[model samples]
Target: MTDQTDEEYREAPSDRTHVKRYHWLARYDQETVKAILDATPLAHVGCMMNGVPFVTPTFFWREGDRVYWHGSSAGRMFHALEHQDICFTVSMLDGLVIARSAYNFNCNFRSVMLLGRAELIKDEDEKAEKLRNFVNGLIPGEWERLRPVYPKEIKATAIASMSIAEASCKVRTGPPIDDDEDYTHPSWAGVIPIRYQVLPPEPDPRNLPDVSMPEDVLKFRLG
Candidate 1:
């Protein structure tokens, strides 16, 4: 992300992340990559285990310039990820574009891909604090009122972290571009906008008579 022009950044930190087609839509700046990852609520984690490839979907969380995700300590994904090369990606599809020609059809989206190895947080106290931050980050005030985490539960979970140092983002927006001759073809051409919204929560039927939705849940926003 340094020693390069905006255009060069698009091509990138390495050939692996370089944008080949539609290179103009790519961005290598730290801000753009971070924002794209933050906007997407989930990150697809990829790694290899026992000579087989695996991609696990997990909640995405960013702290400072790092990315984190958690799973069972004994899980295959976590076991394969520890200090091992891996890739994680996040994407948000914004709309669909209809072009006069079938070949010109495309989807509008923002996406990021990162490469690195995860460092397991071995310190119990630090891991506990990180979990607390992760919970409150997704839902403010929820962690404060929750029951204390048991020692066994902490022992059973694994939290992995890696700096968002090597990554690239590609984003496409606006309407489709069709050949000049195709403009008069009388075919419908426009965008079908997509929206991501948080709907009203449905409380569990088993809640106690006096139980009610918490204020934190009311104001929660995924980012």
Candidate 2:
């Protein structure tokens, strides 16, 4: 965990009633929050343009409790996100938690919804560091292996970052809740675990004969 002073902490008005039964899953430990943030590859950010609203999915990375994403400076999302209120969500499904009753079926998953202000990163050095973080967050040890970004590329792309202060995390685990009457009903109920495994890399026909896949990426594990 990163060290922080008291002044850096902010309490969200929405986090007041965290453990209500209806939103029981919304209460998460710090480790759970970090795990969900680290494992997610993409996030959807919702924002409004004039009277219309939009939800756009894009790649993101987490640094502490902040979420960062980027795109072309002239892109629709990038333009709209600047100086606006945004809500971002990331989710990962682990399995199905089955129960004996029809209403007892539940899902084993982790998700996060963040509310904050989004703005463009204008500093050159900070922009470069954030861009590298976004690329490496998906695959460890990838940023250093890739070639340096061209000057034109930096000028063309825009990076935006939002604080995750006013955020809520929800997770569902274990078996489902069955009705009292359903307890006497005979039915098989259990959980089915899910996982993602990487397939062998496929080479492109136009690639050089000597080119090969990197071991780090080829053997990457989701677990």
Candidate 3:
């Protein structure tokens, strides 16, 4: 945890929330953190088990100030995460910054790091609702058309929720910054932008002949 002066400490302290390196890029605003989380569906969760650090990649969704993820109830990783301290992080690479000098190379990205403990969502009704929201949120109206989650499926899965007790977002955008002398260098330098695009949806071979893609699926776009 980074040390903070008395006045610098937040009312609700998340001791490790501060970004010590490249502090200029750190953003503590709730909206900023939420934006990064909302833009990325994949998250990496880190935790310790048997004195060994483990990081697992999983799909996640955010609602208000809380984040949720689901996994097999029998999985050791989820077992270790439930009711235990964890760090969740999401990052999206936007571009590569090519500079005249190697030392000035950088990446344009948006990222968020959160520190908190996850609580197991054990209530059946609440879990069902959250699962429905997860499906509908990702592709609106799809949940209604799909088969309902069975009680056995719910029993086999574990949903975990972690409040955004302490979080920070870091974003870097625009062009590369090279030394004054590097401006005259022979090498070309600029930002090579990267973006994610939605490709045409492929249907299962066994699908009914009359079925067509839904509007939400056709219009789906990543942030």
Candidate 4:
């Protein structure tokens, strides 16, 4: 795990962080924002390209107040990311709130939006270390068992990190909120819970007969 210092986190909010609608759902605490980011792995990164908007989905991880993501060195998206300001967002849907009236229908979810400029990590050693952290953090003990990352492989990837400079978390949960008159309607209303499940690992057919699943593989879980 990456060591986080007190200075890395602070209650700093920007004009864009304020939630105008449903202001009660906004969360500004650093810890709360970090929790949402940690629970979600996929982030939709939005940036400008040639004076036009562009968004790309990629796997990401958080360490302290910084978020890191990588892509092929040959990708134009990576090139654009390094030179422009970006918005990174992660969201997870928890359930559907079915209400008597269509106007009252909503979904429960947790999400975070961060805005910052990405700094390309150019040091080879630093890149290797961060890459290892990403892999081992996702699957404990897996990095050591796999073949070492080659220099060519490292050279073929572009890794970048962005500070959690301006960020906010918004969440909506609990039962449906309907008008008093709508409650008496014939239609039913409640929350349909949703959860993520991890299935048993499937081994490759070419594996040796004596090989078996590792302890980490059997205990893998996701939020």
Mind sharing the TM-score for model 3?
Answer: 0.91
Q: Rate the local accuracy (lDDT) of all candidates.
A: 0.85, 0.74, 0.84, 0.84
| Residues 1-223, model 4: lDDT tens digits | 1232333323348776766666667777788888888886789999988888988999998988899998998887788987877999999899999999999899999999898889888888899888998888788988898889999989888998998868888788889888998888999899998977778888999998997878988877664
Question: Total clashing residue pairs per candidate?
Answer: 0, 0, 0, 0
Give the per-residue lDDT digits (tens) of candidate 1, residues 78-130: 87787578989999989999999999999999999998888988788888888
- The lDDT-based order of candidates, best leading, equals 1, 3, 4, 2
Please provide, for model 3 over 66-148, each residue's C-alpha lDDT reduced to its tens digit, 9 standing for 90 to 100. 99999898988778886578999999999999999999999999998888888889898898888988888889988899987
Would you list the clashing residue pairs of candidate 4? none
The top-ranked prediction according to TM-score is: 1
**Against the true structure, whose lDDT is highest?**
1
Query: How does each model score on TM-score?
Result: 0.93, 0.82, 0.91, 0.91
Q: Indicate whether candidate 1 or candidate 3 has the larger TM-score.
A: 1
Q: Which stretches of candidate 3 lie over 4 Å from their true place?
A: 1-13
Error of model 4, residue 120, in angstroms: 0.8
Candidate 1 displacement at residue 78 in angstroms? 1.0
Which RMSD does model 2 reach against the true structure? 5.5
Show model 1 residue runs off by greater than 4 Å: 1-6, 9-11
Clashes of 1: 0
